[model samples]
Target: MANHPDQPAFPFRRPNPLRPPGEFERLRAHTPMTRVTTRLGDTSWLATRYEDIRSVLSDQRFGPHLHGGAMGWVGEARTGDSLFQDPPGHTRLRRLVSSAFTARRAEEMRPRVREIADSLARAMRDAPRPLDLAAWFGYPLPITVISELLGIPQEDRKQFRAWSDTFLAVSDETLAAAAQAWSDLNAYVVRLIADKRSGTGDDLLHALIAVRDEQEDRLSESELFMMAISLLVGGYATTANAIGIGALHLLHNGQLGALRADPSRVAPAVEEVLRQQAGGGEMRRVAREDVEVGGVAVKAGETVLIPLEAANRDPGQFADPLAFDIGRAPNPHLAFGHGIHFCLGAALARVELQEAFAALADAFPGMRLAVPAEEVGWSVRLLDEGPKGVPVTW
Candidate 1:
């Protein structure tokens, strides 16, 4: 089939592994907002400029709940996904969960996070040759942290992985299986909430229940359950990918020595990693009304897809955007997104990533990829981007 402008040039290509060389520069040289077909057979307006993306994200008109309306499956959800909410509703849900992710609260979790990272690092250090860091360190640390936070029993994590895998998979077979997974997951969360009610604990679920029934302050059972899912899924998967991929990048780019020499550099390195990582897919939006963004007229109901990876690397916004620079000051990257929908767990993600990289660099200063970079396995259609396995050895 001839390549369609709307369809990514390589539909089956893994997101991070097949990132088009100089994609952002090419988009910037062109104009913003091109018509593109999503993997799910929907047409969307692709927004590439940084300013335009930020505006569209903050604007109330292009909502995340487009699926709930008459649009059907525009490949975006109306409910069950907190990212798809609009104002008042979005505000309410955000407020309810804000306490769990505040800077202070995340900071308080730092010691525990570090302990988790270190334990995983030690395990990796003592493991056999050709260790897959993604499975060993990257996946387990965040999974452990989020499971502990959600009060999920360790025994349930295996099922959690199966459900989450089905949830993120975009293939027809997996898509067909997701509804069942969703049902099972919702039931599981409901039971967890009930358990929290009967036996009080310090976890966020208990904290949520404490105030769930106040007048003008409450979360529906569905909302609470879904929000918890969002935290667990978003919290664990995204950071895990970043840690694994960031470690790979540092190893490949010959910067692990620099990071080891000065652990403080891990902070800036995390930001750069966020800037460089290719997110799994574009952020989807629809025109609330007639809007002119990036000199393009977008009519109501037209879908807009903002590629954060592309925008973060737009040369007009970041000098030498393609080159990863840990010292890139005034970075202003949109990796965490922008506006009211800005990431609530960003502070926690950063702390985990910093601790992870610092510990990894210090422990295995001689670490190198066990295979060629191109040999790393990549799954194209996931919600978060990274290698399926990153084999490394010191």
Candidate 2:
């Protein structure tokens, strides 16, 4: 698993939090699919170009295996984690919760989302000056939204959110810590599922549990537990990151003025924000058979890393790619990724972000970062990355 002498490291560092690693642009243009070594010491085909990355993502020749093992499966197959499995398992699991995240469902939730956003915005406005928006507003907004949607008790949300924060901490930091947090999280979900069976709740979890009981052939106990864990974890983390980073981008580039001026632009502005901040993690896939990527021969069992941020900024796909234009049309960025494994919560996330930024625009039209841009720290995370905290004043 040693790196080749000439092969570049898979994840180059980013000095700027808002931008992807500088190497991505050069690599994307000249050598889109170069061989590189991951931090795991595993060699992988690094795909930077949009066309090649999108092609491999859509291709059936690849599966979720990464670095010769299941991706981040610490215990019990990470059961119900659709990210680690291939279809028809991934397909079926995704189908169970897909209805809750559809565009129509998202629209239905808009009034509630607006209510939450306005409440959080008012709290932020009332808070003491120079507060961290990421902690004070960004993270809590989505966590509360998702927790309420899932029927998690208001009191239980704090405890499980703490566990999730710990669980997301690097696995190598303290294996026991992550394991215990995960176990506690799963146990809580199981208990909550049991609680739902006796009650007549109208939340998403109650409905899902009913489906499991009525059609055991479709959903198993473990899958049910895992899906709960997945939805909670997957539901908030990325959108939370997007809110923090997107807010930072608007503050830096002065896009908030345009948003404040025109309400219709907020939705498209969210899309641009999503497109610009796609540097969190690469999509990892293992070739099931010998395949060619970007004219290079990739043998079976080889790992391929697709950096979504690189593809998002590819000048070939976007004009003035680095510039954050609020009105950027035909913005087809792979922030949520492409293909079947695309994020299941995309529609909901969009609703959250759109509502979030809109509220911020109205609450603090003059909001500005309290410190130098470079002084801001990024999260020490396994999968997604974003501003650790955004200190701002209006």
Candidate 3:
């Protein structure tokens, strides 16, 4: 792939905290799939338009695994998890854990989710004014939910949070920390699995253990460990960030008042939040063979980065794409992604977000940001983009 001098650099940061980077819209209008330099100074094709991004993600020809054993961004290597797996391997792995994250299961957990959210909200209400919602409510809600579902002990939840933070660090300076977190998480999972083997529990981890024991040929110990780690990390971080960002959006747009007046609006409000909050990290894929994206020929072994934020805001796909209309109907955002690799925890995340926002609306209808919107810090370490600390007062 030849680098175009006019092409904006890859991994573009949002000029405004709440909106997609300006370069994304410019790229979407001009060159949908253009060559650009990554943060590591490596050239790759960036797919900006909705149709092109969907094509790249849905098509099997563009797999997550890359040549030279690279996966996604530079310095990121392929893990044995399902994220990097393709075809039969991916299918097999997904099948073993799919039952635990099904829509029905997520729905079944709704009451518990509401309970957790309300409890957290009450705790926030009891605390002093100008509290950090991200620390008190946003992170803990999902962390507790996922931990309970996975049967992880409450005492160990903080360690998991720390490990996940380091594991998702994007900068080269934090690469060592990420690696250490990866090692520590794996070791922890191994120990957890060993503990589960000796006794049975009523959690997802125990169910996975049963499958590994009864169907030894189907699931391996290493696969089980990686799957556990994936569920723990992926399950918590994305939802936590979404809750913080979504709350910020509500507080900014006065949507919380509307939600408080009519609580039923929480569902659509959550969907709209998911749509507008789509700007985060990039999804990576490498061409398995020669493929054309947006009329540009992408050769095999070339990297393709799908900008979810750009695709979600494509004018062709969304009307008034940048607006935060809570009642927007027929919203088909690709925040969870598309096709086979679509997020497995999407339903669970939705439940958590819905309950979270609903609880906040009910508990504190007068909640407002304690600081100026611009004063809130955005996380630079993690892949997801959202407020690092949402300071709120009611």
Candidate 4:
């Protein structure tokens, strides 16, 4: 089925594993905001320019709580997904949870998170060559840190990865698996919330449970359930993927040696990674009222999909956008969305990435891709995108 010229359809094939679809540049240059047909045949507006993408997110007129056939089965609860909810409820929930992810809180976690990263690095050092770093190091560090922060029991850590994958399944092809995974995860969280009431601990989950009251400042049972699920999946998945992606890029770009030689560059390097990645999918929303994005008229109830990866790589914003320069300064990329809708866990994510790459580079400065660069498989589970597995050796 051919797509209309005015409405380009996706899945847009990515002929190159590491690069976004080349059409993004063409759209950004000619029509920053144009109508798009999603893979499911739902029509939405696509926003590609850096400035326009930022504007759409920050404007309250472009809201969350998007509903359409494109969101698929997992999005049946999109209204409750903390990432897609609008205020004043979103404002209240964000304010309540902000305490747990404040800069101070993330700083406090650095020592422990670093310890986790170092431990993984040590194990990697001793293991046989050509290990799947994604399995051994990439997924483990963030999963461990998030589990600890959420007060999830040690026994529950393993299943968290599989459960979190539910958010990645945004298409009907995987609807059955997504449904089962979501059901299992939902039941687990409900049980855990019940279990937490009888205990006394200082985890985020405990804090959330204690706030559930009969009065105005309270979270409903469903809100609590959704919040917990969102945190679990959002906390670990992208960071885990980035570890592998960042490592692959660092090696491919020959920046690992520089990073190892100068420890201070790790933080900036992490920012670069996020800028380049911007997650594997577009940020979705619908206009609550009429909105003008880059001079394009977007009517109320119209869906807008912003491919942040494209925005981050916009040459107009970044100098030599494709080059991987660790020292790139004044880099204002929108890998993370802007405005009040900014990511709450941004601080915590930074802590994990900085510590992770520092520890990895320290342990194996010579580490390189085990297979040919082109051989590394990339998977796109709906909106979630990243390397499938990055096998590497020193």
TM-score pick, better of 1 and 4:
4
Predicted structure 3, TM vs. truth: 0.94
Please write out the lDDT profile of model 1 over residues 172-256, one tens digit for every residue: 6555577677667777877878878889687777777766645324577556667777887787888888887787788778888
Output candidate 2 Cα RMSD: 1.9
- TM-scores vs. true structure, each candidate: 0.90, 0.95, 0.94, 0.94
Pairs of colliding residues, candidate 2: none
Error of 2 at 263 (Å): 0.6
lDDT of 4: 0.81
C-alpha lDDT (0 to 100) for residue 386 of candidate 1: 68
RMSD of each: 3.3, 1.9, 2.3, 2.2
Candidate 2 lDDT for residue 212: 90
TM-score of 2: 0.95
Instruction: Quantify all predictions' global Cα lDDT against the true fold.
Output: 0.74, 0.83, 0.83, 0.81
What digit string (tens of lDDT, one per residue) describes model 2 on residues 241-266?
89998999999887887788899999
lDDT, candidate 4, 175-218, per-residue tens: 67777777788789999999998888999998888887434356
| TM-score, predicted candidate 1 vs. hidden true structure | 0.90
